[model samples]
Target chain A: MLKKMENNTGNFYIDVASIQKEKHANEICGDVFLTKKVSAEDRTIIVLSDGLGSGIKANILASVTASMAVNFTSMNAPLAHTAEIILSTLPVDRERKVGYSSFTIIDIEAGGTIHFVEYGNPEILYFRENETLELKKTPVTIKNRFRLKQPLFYSNCTGRRNDRIVVCSDGISQSGIGSRAYPFGWGIKNVNAYIRDEISRHPGISSFDLCRKLLANAIANDTFKAKDDITAGVVYLREARRLMVCSGPPYDENKDTMLARDLDRFAGTKIICGGTTANIIAREMHREICTNLSHTSFQLPPVSSMDNIDLITEGILTLGKAHRLLEEGFKPDLVSKDPAVMLCNHFLLHDEIVFVVGTKVNEAHQDPSLPVELEIRRNVIKKIARELEDNYLKTININYI
Target chain B: MTEITICSGTLCYIMGGADIFEIETKLSEMYNDKIRIKASTCLGFCEGENKQNPPCVMVGNELIPDATIEKIINHLKRLYTR
Candidate 1:
């Protein structure tokens, strides 16, 4: 768990919490900050991504999405346009079909303007003094028809001051406070009322605390374990804010040079790499890279920050799909129109970023030197990028190295 | 000339490996003047899970799984030599 106080023009704080359940062999759902950067005004902008399907591949989709979104949103571009650019930029995997991720964006301006947009999940609830609740649900949603489920755009209502927004995945909802499957097709009012009546009570309670209560409520209601990874993000708005960008170990050996190059161009350059990359990069750059003996995974850098892109990814998809439905002309009080949201919200994190690193084939029992299916995968990536208007970085930025 | 079929459906693409299309390209390059290759939407087998076994191949009435370029080439070689 990590906490930071922002000294920006606005008074704002954020409390985030995520929990994953072993839903089976293949499903895992979590949240991720695609990328994080402090805006010129010193406020923090966060984007969450939820990849389609579950388990490791789903984690990678959400991870890459959060990383890219965080990296670009810092530029303070229009969220809609920035989202479009990101959609266009992702590399599509032929096996997983990686063109889309459920996205939710929270922008805390210096003056404390909380702009919230969700694409998949429903609007998070704000519970405060006397159980006064605020639910900023999107006006539209993507509903899954029997067949022909396509990505749809939706619009979001503006944010209210000091409104605590609780964004989450269906896993959180399905788990529900009572542990009975979330009353399918239940509206935000029902969700909000349940939280207010059962969970949120007390002033200045951190959002993360509220998240825990919500998850605990769900678990306590039923005797069975959750079948999916559960994720929840809470954003508290006041007036002040600060931002942190968590970097992780490189997927490839050349990451040392890449880090040096990226750090040279960006200000407040803090190089945080993990494990072998951490040791080598820190030694070469003369910077400190945090170490953890508990986790041997190569993705220790960003995960070390506790932002845990895996969790954020689930939040993004649930929220992004919710937002898309609103944009496409659905009402928050109505049913969602997108089926991808349901399928995408079902997974957990991967041990490493897939396909991007290692030889053409690694330990997956394939030939290492051969490019396997590069052309097909590349085409899928290109088609998605073109359709979504995302800036897919086809070539690794050698300048970073 | 050799005829090649590439299935782009969900299951075939998934079980067949996304890189299966390279087989056609490799064959084309190796026997550039000898074969004609193209892509098709679905081979009717990928729709149901039953037809989705590994290395699924159809030559006349023969269904081959774990079908590789070598196997494909040898089959073609036999037909051509005959």
Candidate 2:
């Protein structure tokens, strides 16, 4: 259990999230991210770097800069030295006369002492319960032996449960720069007001969704064809969420008791997938399996229920169908209340996902009558793991038993 | 010419190692011109009443279960060498 300590304002847990958008049909996004320290119990470190240009070069530059930033922070290097190193090392665009990479670093210690540095990047907007808080920054000039000189803006603050910090690339702050919508760029003032309005309306949005919303609206301001690579990193301090999913069953019949006991022992919400797997757990627990013969998708099999299993589903069909739905972007309300959708919602809502995957293969999954796509069990689940990590930024632990 | 069908469907992919798909490159690299590896949507094995051992691979008319790199390569070597 996490002991709640009072920060300057209130006690809360830290949650950091980010999302990216490449300009137009470009394969490479110029924005690179560093979130290596978020899972640390006492500290949170997140950095977003935007390379000078777009595509491969930009990606490489941003990647190098973000990686170096994380490494330096880990080594506890001075911010001035770190800034000078980056400014000198990164190549400059000849015509633009600008360093190839710019980054924003947000570092928060336990008990919500927030420290951040912005270098040639958009200023981050801090909020406290739908009301905006203006940050006070000190400019530090960085110089190295190479005679390279660069300046970085540094700031510090205290945070509460409902505080949100949104930092983004110029793609967001300068969205629709020359567009007819505003005739001027989507400046900091405009972005600030928009976020305040959004917070007031939703109030309970997760940091991930808030970042996504900001990026989406920013891209929309650029008329879907973004003029730049848009990226937003959101750090939201709030309560914690945890979830556990049990999919498949062990091939060894002897371990059924172990699997059942594991599910029963799991403190978080438990989801059991696969009809046979659910039956195995039910039989092991000496509980009756109740069949729910309702319809989620007419083409897929119906759902089932048993005691202690938060969700019971028809193995591959539910997983495959859910993968397709989630692949299209997991929208909680849009998905019907089927086992798969319910399971997807469970995955989306929680911060931590514990996947207990049984190696047992269900004989029913190879049926020729079913769609070939439904026959995919491991691959789809594997895809789900990747998608959850990449898109939703959920921490997943796959326990293969 | 030999017809080697690899089941790309889910059950076989999972029950048998996902490496079953990698047989294509190995077969191609070895037999060069003699073997043709193709993906079958579903071979109707590992599910229903007609389920068979999987991950299933077909070497011409013979369907091999739990097809491994060594097992498939040995069979190919036997058939072509003979």
Candidate 3:
């Protein structure tokens, strides 16, 4: 998996989960996927299936369907046609088995264009910028051919960068938890709202953290000790690799001189600016800067802002606008070479410093109020930091400070 | 008098034959407040282990597996007619 991640391009990610529970002799319900990043071409293929029934049989059903779909798609089959073949070739229910699996396929190119094919209820949700969309089959399940024939056919669509795509099993929408034991499925309607809140809280979060938080919340809401299998995948897109450059606080008292000198130098690199730093830079430059609220350079006849200051505000707004511009089904990725960054004179900033009172002899001291064992906190924190370091070298910058 | 409780989670619902309300209606018509019917959440009986032998309903202390409308009706008739 690490090898695959290292070689993958275009910021593609996938998540898979299942449970063999004591509640059911056959935990047949869950999802299966055959995924790989085609590094050379920067295209990623993700084929997923939700098997019929529970336990081993259901697992086999979904596994066969996913394996076949991925194999065929890798041969370059078109998304819709590939889905049709998988649907048609199944057991066909001739022996009164009444078994079939839901399937979806997505092919994302290096340029961040997403092509999707979906059949059955497990849907593909797109959250671009912060707007979400669901590309799903009709709500009614396709148990028999009669149901499959109506306008209830599966759907296919394509989208572009700064857009996010989420694929989920029906289990997530159906799960229940909490005092009222409310269902936390987020369904199609609330998946976007949920993602937007998560992204806003933890802007640099990895895909794994997002998936874990969603499932954990679902479990907490469920009254049953055991829950149905839950799975959700998030893919964020951008027109170019987004570079968030954090400038350290200003080193000197000459604020205007520092801003004027530092702003132009960073601007010369052509990276757009945002946040408070962009505003400060614009005020110092004393000129109107160009920017777009839509974040899309393609909007209208292409309205560009007036000066460098306006341009920097436009850039900051552009990032916000980019997040705002996404509706459901959009996948965000670098669509162009325009990288967006924050402009600053190192820093006019916010910093927090906490005083520590600990047993210097122990290096860590136990809290009398905590019910946990003496060393549990230290051990748990160490284990989590180790895991974070192992999985996400990019996001987990483990500086002790 | 016989008491019946049915499971209401997603799988049991999918398995169908909940029919608790109809069973209650039938009992009220036949026994006139002599019998009681209730709906409950999952009894933790999932597929595979039950091997699709579910749609469970508890009648007193005895569990009726693969419960159907006919099964409940028969059980109630046998217990209450006496």
Using lDDT as the measure, which candidate wins? 2
Name model 1 segments beyond 4 Å from true: A1-12, A16-22, A26-30, A33-40, A91-98, A127-162, A176-189, A198-200, A220-223, A238-401, B1-82
What TM-score goes with each of the models? Answer: 0.40, 0.61, 0.42
The candidate with the higher TM-score, 1 or 2, is: 2
Candidate 2 residue-wise lDDT, A228-267, digit = tens: 9999888878765667778777867788899999898888
Q: Write the per-residue lDDT of candidate 1 for residues B1-82, one digit (tens) a residue.
A: 5555443322343454345555654553556767654433234453245644444455544554555667766776776678
Global lDDT of each model? 0.43, 0.76, 0.46
Which pairs of residues collide in model 2?
A: A274-A315, A363-B47, A375-B10
Model 3, stretches more than 4 Å misplaced? A1-29, A92-96, A133-162, A177-186, A238-401, B1-82
Superior candidate under TM-score, 2 versus 3 = 2
Q: Write the per-residue lDDT of candidate 1 for residues A141-175, one digit (tens) a residue.
A: 23222222334343333333344666666555655
For every candidate, give the share of true A-B contacts it also has. 0.00, 0.06, 0.00
Candidate 2 docking DockQ:
0.04
DockQ of each: 0.01, 0.04, 0.01
